[model samples]
Structures are given as C-alpha cells and as structure tokens.
Target: MTHMSMSYLSLIVVTMVIGMGASWYVNRQINKYLHVPASMRVTGAQMAEMMLAANGVHGVQVYRGGPQQDHFDPRNNSITLDPDAFGGTSITAIATACHEAGHAIQFAQGYAPMKIRGALVPAVNFASNAWVFLLMFGIFMQLSGLTTLAIVMYAVVVLFQLVTLPVEFDASRRGLAYLKTQGISQAEQGGAYSVLRACALTYVAAALTSILQLLWLLQSRDE
Candidate 1:
C-alpha cells in the first residue's frame, strides 16, 4: 500500500476511535441522568409541550419514537421523542425533550442558521451519497477531474456539518436556559448540562473526522 493510503487508514482509525468514544461518553452521561427524576416530575412529552407553549409556538406536534431517535422535524413541524424521552420524568428526558422544543422555537422565530441547514438538507443528502461513489470511480479510473469534483461535493457535506454545529449548540443553550428560567428541573440542571454538552461533542467529532478525511482525499489526488 502507498504511504498516503497508510496515512489515510491511520486517520480513519483515529477518527473512528474519537467518534465511538464520544458516542460512548454521551450515552454514559445520558444514562446517568436518565434515572434521576426531575424536581417538577414532568414527563418528557409534557415538558416539550410546556416549552412550546411558553414560546408561543403552536401547530408543532410532539410524538413518541424509538430509543434515541428524538429529533425535531422541520418539514412536518413536529418533535419526535424516544419512548424514554416521551414518557419518563427523569432529568435527561426533560432536557432532551426541551432541546427538541428548542428546535421548534427556532423554526417559529425563523432562526437563520436553522433555515440554512433546512435549505441544505436536499443538497447535503445528494452530496453525501454521491461523493463516495465519485471518489472511488475517480481513483479507479485515475481521473483527476472526477476526484476534484468529488472533493467539491464532499465539501458540501462539511459545510452542512459546520452549519449544524451552531444550530445544535443554540438549541441546547435555549433548552437549558428555559429550564433554568422557568424553575423546571432546577435541581437537575448540572446533569442536564452535562448530557447536552456531551451530545454536542459528538457533532464536533463528526466534523473533525470529515475534515481529516477530506484532507486525506486531497493528498491522494495530489499524488
């Protein structure tokens, strides 16, 4: 194998380690708070509904989903929470539910970053699926043009990740602030903070991994 290929492999190993480590840490943090009931003893779904109502955000529905699949869907104006997050009164559940509510609030307020991310969803999806195939075909055919095009397409994916960072961070910030301001889950604020912060790190790891992979691809093309 070539030196560049070896280096790329090493980068991949490192990136995978970081990604897995972040995921593990986040899960651990979440689990730690999952059993600790909030002072208000509100279910995740109730908490989400309260947050949305507090923000004067109407028309957004909250529903139950599979484990760890909680997210706010902009297209449908709905927030889907995992079973635990939808029914549990634990600190983790409330915090997570509020975070999704934060997204709903963003949509209501027309947050610019969220809007940008929503706009890029289609292009990002296309680039993510097409880039790898183009890169492999380019490498096999020894076509510099195709490789360069692939790199450009991959950059779109990177941009989407970059935009996502601020959106996620802002959501967490808003969620935490709402919890504290409303005196809900006040006693469990620390645990909620930790859970959200750990979750944010996964996004950081992802963006960094993509950047490293893009660099490796660039080096391969130059060679």
Candidate 2:
C-alpha cells in the first residue's frame, strides 16, 4: 500500500479509537453518577419542568423515553428523558434532564447558534446520506466536478457538527448554572458537571473525527 493509503487507514483507526473512548467515558460517568443522590430529591421529569419554568419557557411537554433517548425536540417543543433520567433523583438524572431543559430554554430564547444549527439540520441530513454515494461514484467515474460537489456536500455535515459544539456546551453550562442556583452540594454539583462534561466530550470527539475525515478527503482529492 502507498503512504497516502496508509495515512488514510491511520486516520480511520484514530477516529474509531477516539469515538469509542468518548463513548465509554460518557457511559462510565453516567453509571457512576446514577447512584449519587441529588439534594433536591426531584425526579428528572420534574427537574426539566422546573428548569423550563425558571427560564420562563412555557408550552413544552416532558415525556419519558427509552434508555439513552434523552433529548429536547424543537419541532414539538418537548423534552424527552429515559426512564432513569425521567424518574430517578440521582445526580445523573438531574444533570441530564436539566441539560435537555437548557435546550428548551435555548429554543424559547432563540439562541443564535441553536437557531442556526436547527436551520442546517435538513441540509445536513440530506448531505450525510448522499455524500458517500456521490463521492464513490465520482471517484469511480473520474469526474473531478462530481467529486468536488460531494466534498462540498460532506462539508455541510462537518459545518453542522461544528455548530453543534456551541449549542451543546451552552446547554451544559445552563444546566450547571441552574444546579448552582439551587444550592446543590459541591459534591453533587461536581458529579453533575462530570456527567455533562462527559456527554460534551462525545460531541467533541465526533466533531474532531469529522474534521479529520474532511481533511483526508480534501487531501485525497488534491492528489
């Protein structure tokens, strides 16, 4: 194999390692904090509702979802949490539920980055699904223009991932800030922060992997 091909394989291996490490760390954090009780003693669902109310956000519903399904949906103005997060009073529950509530707050407040990320969702979705085929076909057919177009499409995906970082970090910040306001014990607050930060790392890993892949694609095309 040529040096370029070896470098490409190395990039893939590095991306996979980073992605797996991030996933494992986040899961470990979640499980570790899941046993630590929060002082407030409120379920994750209630915490989410309270956070939304504190932010003067109304008309949003909170639902219980399956495991690892916690998220805030802008389209329906709803927050959904997994069974543990929706009902448990553990630090993990508090952190995750409020983090999602932070997203609801962003939607209500029209946070600029959040809005921009939302707007890019459709294009990113299409690009993510279509780019691989386009690139493969372009390369096989020796069409420079098509390959360039494919790269451009893939870039949209990378852009969306980049924009996602701010939205995610800001949400975690909001959640932690609210936890502080509630006078949570330092230990509990620290636990909450750990969970949120670990979650954020997954996004960071994803963005870095996408960036590396984009760079590799550009380099390959150039050669």
Highest lDDT scorer: 2
What is candidate 1's lDDT per residue for 160-199, written digit by digit as tens?
9999999999999999998997675445888899989988
Residue 215 CA error for candidate 1 (Å)? 1.3
Off by over 4 Å in 2: none
Clashing pairs in 2: none
Off by over 4 Å in 1: 184-187
- By summed lDDT, which 10 consecutive residues of candidate 2 come out lowest? 1-10
Residue clash pairs of candidate 1: none
TM-score of 1: 0.97
- What TM-score against the true fold does each predicted structure earn? 0.97, 0.98
Worst 10 residues of 1 by lDDT: 181-190
Report lDDT (Cα) of residue 27, candidate 2.
93
